[model samples]
Target chain A: MIRRDLVFEIGRTLIAIALALLLGFVIVLLVSEEPFNAFINFVAGPLTTTRRIGNWIEATIPLIFTGLAVCIAFQAGQFNIGAEGQLFFGAVTATIVALTFQLPMYLHVLVALLGAMVGGAIAGAIPGIMKARWGANELVSSLMLNYVFYRLGLYLINYHYRDSSAGAMVSYRLPETSWLQQFWPPTRVHWGLWVALAAILFSYLFLYRTRWGYALRMTGLNKDFAAYAGISVSAVIIYSQVISGAIAGLAGAADVLGLYRRFQWQQLPGYGFDGIIIAILARNHPLGVPIAALFLAYVRSGASIMSRMSDVSAEMVAIIQGIMILLVTAQAFLAKWRHRSVVREAKKHGLNA
Target chain B: MGSTLKGIFSVGFGYSMLRVTTPILFAALGAVVSEKAGAVNIGLEGLMLISGVTGVIVSAWTQSAWLGLLAGLVLAVLFALFMGYFHIKLGTDMVLAGIAMNVIASGGTVFALFVASGDRGISSSLASKVLPTVELPLINKIPVIGPILSGHNVLTYFALLAVVGVWYFLYRTPLGLRLRAVGESPDSADSVGISVSKMRFLALGISGFLAGFGGCHLSMGYVSWFSRDMTAGRGFIGLAASALGGVHPIGTAIASLFFGFADALSNYMQSLSIPSEFVQMIPYLATVAALGVFARRQMSRERKGKKQAGREVA
Candidate 1:
């Protein structure tokens, strides 16, 4: 039975991927005359070079953090849509600490990471507290927080932390002591990948093995039933949010201290939204998040390489991602296919219901 | 200082508020209709975004604002129909589908921009035409209020008319009742021979039409061109207003006006030497505040009901 289920899951994933590719190909054929070249570039461009592989790893690091963050909240039935805002706040907080301290390299990095956690926690807790205390919908609160943090980041970058020499909305460079050590030479990929892996392992353990985790899952599945069984539903919701926020913040810290030389104020990177897609595709499983993140990162990296290699725009990859998401989220189509297959098998066995 | 204060009042902050509210009013009304039919259309943002681009593109190409408005609405309606087919017929999660639609719309517009014009953002500098303001000559001759009400974009007038139109449709019409019945209890509606799915699809289609017009107003009426992600968070803001307004057309109109007033105030304050960043934060801050208030009220009502049940048992 287990083998059958695994096979079915793999089949579903493959089918979805195939459909997405077909749709993307059709779009490309319509738009570009050199469709075959574009298709080849889109599929194989990222695999051809070492530097591109490094870029994939670099992109995957933050996605791993944010994806895991989203997974935790989603599993708890709390859609923490504020990951983008939380990431911004996290990066800013880490930037502040990384700039202020002149400690040892390891200590500086640790402090920056901790600051990111705190920043994310505070930002994440707002919606959680509002939901718990007053019944404010977490979805709206979290989404609104994205705009707030975006403007706040802009304010800080433009006025308070401005590196005037940069000539735009940017901040001062962090001290070298705070910088994360690189994993490979000539590539920007750093130790953040290891940190992300550790986070994934920790999240998996926390969700599947712990008593608290079980209770949190119970609460998520049915608040009324969980309350009847004497679980503190509100507490679990709040805790899940804070943890999710911290993870997202860590992602921001990883980006800033591990990669960027100086803080550039981005309104909000679509990383949070990407994380949402990852969480959904992974079915909110901690172990599945990293895989999904890697897949998405690979697509992004591949698309960039393809853009460089051929006339096809990298934006075509986004179109594919959107179509895939639409198909996956609309499970009715999947259900219909499944129903048809089941009916056909039953007919063959003369066991029609 | 007194003269400045009077100028602030006389400068028609109310008109500015109305101008800002127009797009939101259309969007909030769309949300009300959709929500009343049991389909949560979180894709309002995407619908508006795509419509905005379509309106700008068509207008720029044809040099006709009306053509742009029509194109935007038509595309919006088609998108709504697609969403309805996926969610109502195919049983997709509304929120996820909405998010996907948004991402597709945003990315698609940017891609199309690159294809249409070599620019990655803020469409062709060919100086596209905008919807002209219609001046009511006789009305303009009236007092201060006349100038405030008259000489506005045609879409603005349409938005005002939509408030009453939506209210009447939702309250007085049989179709509206059926839509509400589905929203309240779809199982019951189904048992009574009402096609819950059909009603939902129709509601969503209407929603898409309204949202498309809203987008047209944003691009053709207000700015005359499309910029990347130019709708910003107005669609989401409209959703919030719809919720805060208790999903009623009149209430949503009021809420939209309040939000628009906040937006206009921020813009006005920015002109008075205030930091633009700080000014920009006002609308977002207001959304949070509104949500906080709405949530608190809901909690208190639940608590009160619980207390009443406890007293009755005693």
Candidate 2:
């Protein structure tokens, strides 16, 4: 039964991706002068160079973290979109630790990451507590907090952490001990890869093996049922959000320490929002998140290459993402086929029995 | 202190507040209409963006602001209807669909902008027409009140009028009753022969219509040309306003004004030597704080009501 369910889930996602890509190709044909070239580059350009492959891997790291974060929250049935704010807050906290702390290399990295998690957890707690305690709409409140933290981060960077000699409104460079060592020489990929893997593994175990995870899944499946079953639904809501925020915060820290020398992000890094698409594609499963993140990262990197090589812009991937999300989530999209397959399987099992 | 007082008490400040409030008011009213029909239009932000850009491009191409307004409204309604089909007919989750719509709008508008004009950031190349501002005949003669109340963009008046229009329609009209009935209980409404899907579609259509006005006001009256993400978070702010107002027209309007005041304060704070980033953060922070307070009050009130009901039953 589980195997059949997995097959259907995979089948639906694959079909949705294929259809979205096909539509994207049509859009390219309509808009681009060199449609064939653009589409080719968009599909195969990342494979052409080792450096480009590095770009894909580097991109995939943050997506995995955020995808896991979003998966956890969604599994709890909370639409806490404040991952964006949590990410920004986490990044800033990490930057602060990186700039100020005087520890050994690994210890410094550990402390910074912990700081980011705390920052993100606190950021996540606000909207979570509001919703769990007072029944506030988590979606709107999270979005509001995103803007607030983004601006607050900007203010902090501008006033306290500004590298006066640097060109833009950005923070000072991190200490040398704080930088995550690059694991791949040709690429900028760092220790964050292992960290992300650990996160995925940890998330999977936490969701599948833990009592709290059971309560979270129960709450997501049916809140009233969960409440009747003696689960503390409110506690589940708050902690799920907190855990999600901490993961997202970890992504922000990993991204900054692994990639850049200086805190150069002038705007909200949009990984949190992209995480939503990744989570949806992954069916909100931690085990599925890495695969989904890889797919998205590949497509995104390909689009960038396409933009560089052809007339089409990188924004085309957003259209594909949007269409894919809608199609995959649509309950009626391939309902007839799914129903037939289910019936056929049942009949076969009945005959065998 | 004197400069701050002057900035706050001036007629120009009030006028600017009303100007900034127009899009938010339209969005709030749109949110209210859709919420009444038991559908939350989280796509109001994207809808506004789509219409805002449409207004700019169409007006520039046709050299007529009225034509642009018409096209914008038409396109917004069409998209809303499409969302209706996806959500109602295809059984997609409303929030997910709305998020998808937002993503599409964010990307699609920029694509269209680049195709129509060479620039990717702003529509400065296009000779887009701005909507005319109207000066009230008698009000224009009045002292401080005149400048604050008169000589505003035409859409500003429409937004004010829409508040009352929405109130009357939602309360007094039979169709409004049906929409509310559909929202209140779709099963009961369906049992009574009222089409739940149709009412929802109508609710979304009205939402799109009102949001369209907000969009037009942005590109036309708020600024002379369309810029990328000109609507910013106004759509979300409007949604918050609708929620804060308890989904009532009058209450929503008042809530929108409160947000508008925060927005205006942010703008004024830029002149007060505070960091621009901190000042800009005011409205967004205000939104979160306000939602917290509002939700707390509502929950407490519900608790009280439940206690009273239990006592009566006993």
Q: Worst ten-residue run, lDDT, model 1 chain A?
A: A1-10
Q: Give per-residue CA lDDT, model 2, range A235-275, as digits (tens).
A: 99999999999999988898888898667788777898889
Return the top candidate by DockQ. Answer: 2
Q: Choose the strongest candidate by lDDT.
A: 2
DockQ for each candidate?
0.65, 0.70
What value does the lDDT take at residue B310 in candidate 1?
100
For residues B166-247, could you state the per-residue lDDT of candidate 2 as single tens digits?
9999999999999999999999999999999999999999999999999999999999988877888788888888877889
Using alpha carbons, what is the TM-score of model 1? 0.93
Model 1: per-residue Cα lDDT at residue B274: 60
